[model samples]
Target: MALFGKALLIWLMILLLAIANGILRESVLLIVVVKTAAFIVSGLLLCLCIFIMTYLALPWFGRLPASHYWRIGALWLVLTLAFEFVLGAVIQGHSWAQLSEPYTFKDGNLWTLVLCVTFTSPYLAARLRFKQGSKFL
Candidate 1:
């Protein structure tokens, strides 16, 4: 039960943090800050969200050979690109297909690889953290 609570809390916090990107937008609160600050915050949030989700899902990946972790990461990246960029706007009734037509890459827009790295790094970190017998600080 404690593990469940820990996982749930982490999930909620990660979600709320990620959602802040859209909710906060680029308000005067952030606009006044240095340019790099925004990107740093953005990167931190992505890393946190990826960490929490992948950590929670790790046990579900049981008995899968260690060699396949990258597959999980790749699938996650594909899903993210599909949901967030491709189908998301359509679901929201926006014309995403038309907008993406201007771009040459059918695989995904520019941030796909960036988001993939964000997702994978945390899984690796959690693995390292476990191996090192460290707890979250």
Candidate 2:
């Protein structure tokens, strides 16, 4: 239960990072590049941020087994999808098609790649941390 709580907290932090990334995408990237390019760049940036954050937060998981790390990643993925679809459609008034557009890979949107990264980051981070024998871990 404690581990699950910690994972949820970490996920919330990741959500904040994502929100910041969205702001950057809107304010900076969109101005600097075409919409397609901005979407691609934003997705890649988010993936890098997620991986780095997961790496840094691994110590908080306290030397968990790899399976636990995988579970954490799965949890994050599910939470992200639910938030994107539910909140985007209900609160934001985006149509279902609009919400699903990114997944179509049209206009260079890299949402699918971003989701893959989100699902794998925790396990990948844990592997790297274990391989490096991080003192914090």
Q: Identify the candidate with maximal TM-score.
A: 2
Lowest summed lDDT window (length 10), candidate 1: 102-111
Tens-place lDDT per residue, model 1, 38-128, is 5455555566566766665555444334445555555555555665565456666668666554244343222433475645753584575
Any residue pairs clashing in model 2, and if so which?
A: none
Q: Against the true structure, what is each candidate's TM-score? A: 0.52, 0.93
Ten contiguous residues with the weakest lDDT in model 2: 128-137
**Candidate 2 lDDT over residue span 89-108, tens digit each:** 98999998899898998977
Model 2 Cα shift for residue 121 (angstroms)? 0.7
